[model samples]
Target: MIKTLDSVSNHEHRQIIEKTGYKVETLRIWKTGILKHSISNPSNEQLETFAMNVDAVLEKSNLHIDSKNEIRANCTSHFLNERRRTSKQGKETKENIKVVNNIKKKIRDNNLTVVKADKGSCMVILDRNLYINKVEEFMNENGFVKLDNNPTSRLINKVKNFRVSKEFEDKFGKYKNLIPSNPKIPKLYGLPKLHMDNIPIRPIVSLINTPVYKISKFLSDKLKDLTEFKPTYSIKNSGQLAESLKNLQIRRVLN
Candidate 1:
């Protein structure tokens, strides 16, 4: 439904237009210029990530969250088993086994980068170099070197317990990006809102880290609405206090 595309911004937009047979014509008007990002896919991963990032900010408004134990239980009964069982339903039992084997193959192919102990409270993966840097930065900023305890101590206990009352999925209900670079960003419909996002450091070196904020659909949708093109311009021009708070929070987490 878009007409002449204006000056488009970002690589994803350009990629979409290129792949989708959309054309763009950039024009300058007076002293100002306008952009028109036209596309057939209309949806993008970066936009999804942005919505998630903004939603984390909105979740702070609720001042409620779940504890670590509840988060772990929800992760087990809901996420892990549910995915396995759901995959088994639509396909032959052997096909489901094949799917699970492929997943295992992927895990093993990565040199078993992630390893876990059943009884241990912490999940440890092979350390990646780049992730080390980010984690170090996070530590320098927050005076903490470990993420294992942070989830249980800092955030898990701080938030109130919530349940997966209903099934949830992403905006398009298509799993575009299941993992994130920022752990604080909320999952689509998963419980234990807070998680450890990873960064690749090297062939095997990666840093696993956590986010300070935990978010849900209510916050995600609100942030999406608030961050559409109009709100961004308004925030840039008039939202000094809000911007400062945002900067502060980012600094607190990332340093």
Candidate 2:
């Protein structure tokens, strides 16, 4: 039930619309609230325009939009829709999961392949035969051989059974941080770099899934602190490097 009070601010108007559904089932609510976002110069036309913006936002969010105003405050009406209590997330049934898995299996069975383009900004799809041919050609040109067996299991076992000396532990902390638990095989994918003279396949090996990833990360972080403000090792470009070199004090360094 909307009590027609004086004009309220736009923010207050949206709050009511968001709470109240197409029909206000609760008749017990008699409280009216106003928030001072700005000076409330109540106008009916402004309310209508504000409601249109609310509709756009709600629509974009995949939310229910109440086109008609059922609640009134002051002389103006504000749009309100009931919250969808039925809408839930992560409530998929077992049958739904099985169906989804089956669909995925079917897709994989057809020998479809995917790789991240620009590190997951998007994916580029190509013919399976063409992709394999390109990768094989690159490997052959580089004199790389394809291994007969998977080596991920062997690597994981080796890391798990590894031992560290006391002196090493004292300098670099514990052994646990240096080893990855349940490490997946490192993945390699190539991106067709278009900006190059010849669009070369820029081979990338995903280090995140490697057995020594944790050790690499720990060592990298420890070593990074030493290089924070070094004079010669500038990464920002040639201009920044020149500026940094100009500011270096060579006499003080020798002394």
Candidate 3:
């Protein structure tokens, strides 16, 4: 397996793997069905120490819940600092996760879902069925209807046929390079607005791989060049906005 990994062409391969390494021994001992522990790349001495520590905890410490929790040794618990920690640990632990246990029953009883925060690496707990109903309500309010069947394949064929048609080719031949070779069906999804009181789901249409992607991109680029003349109103960032505000003037209207 090491030899096979070394022979893998895409990598700047290691010439020879280290002998008596913990990782190598782990792979050598690995089974087909069983997954290996991610962080427990323990050497012989570390393994022995870990076993002794576990024995110490079980013998010296009470098997009671609070005592068991109190007996959490760094050596006994693998990757004490890293195993269950996430990048958003500070934010989550401080604001969200601390109260999660208290609300667990309330969530389960209400049949709510615990989904991810939209803009940040946090959690947003909301009822998924209720969320779906609200989304459906919004869609209905905006005159959007549910389709009876998926029209993705049919839509693709239609677009492809139109692209190859004589009239279409004649009209759009100059922009052939801008046309996408392969197009994907567009998807619509919603992100939870956690900051809002009602926690509305903000609708977003993902268009990167869709049929209109290339044409829309081209049009946007063209429009940008045309609209760049209005520099005062077309503020993009905070810096530009600030600069625009600084130069603002309200002229008195001549009656």
Q: Cα lDDT for residue 58, model 1?
A: 49
lDDT of 2 by residue, 73-98 (tens): 31232222111221221232333444
| Top lDDT model | 3
The TM-score measured for candidate 3 stands at 0.41
Candidates by TM-score, descending order: 2, 3, 1
* Candidate 1 residue lDDT tens string, 206-250: 223333332444456667787763554444544775765775644
**CA lDDT of 241 in candidate 3?**
76
Judge candidate 2 at residue 71 and give its lDDT. 20
TM-score of each model, paired residue for residue: 0.19, 0.44, 0.41
- Candidate 1: which stretches are off by over 4 Å? 1-144, 147-151, 161-217, 227-255
Candidate 2 clash figure, as a count: 5
lDDT, candidates in the order shown: 0.36, 0.51, 0.55
lDDT of 3 by residue, 1-255 (tens): 332222323212122111222244333322121232233333558667866777676777558865665555544565444434543454444443334343455457767655444555444445558667857766878899778988877866665565445775586564456546777778766766555555566787889877768778877877878788455546689997788689789899998
For candidate 1, the per-residue lDDT at 210 reads 31
Full ranking by lDDT: 3, 2, 1
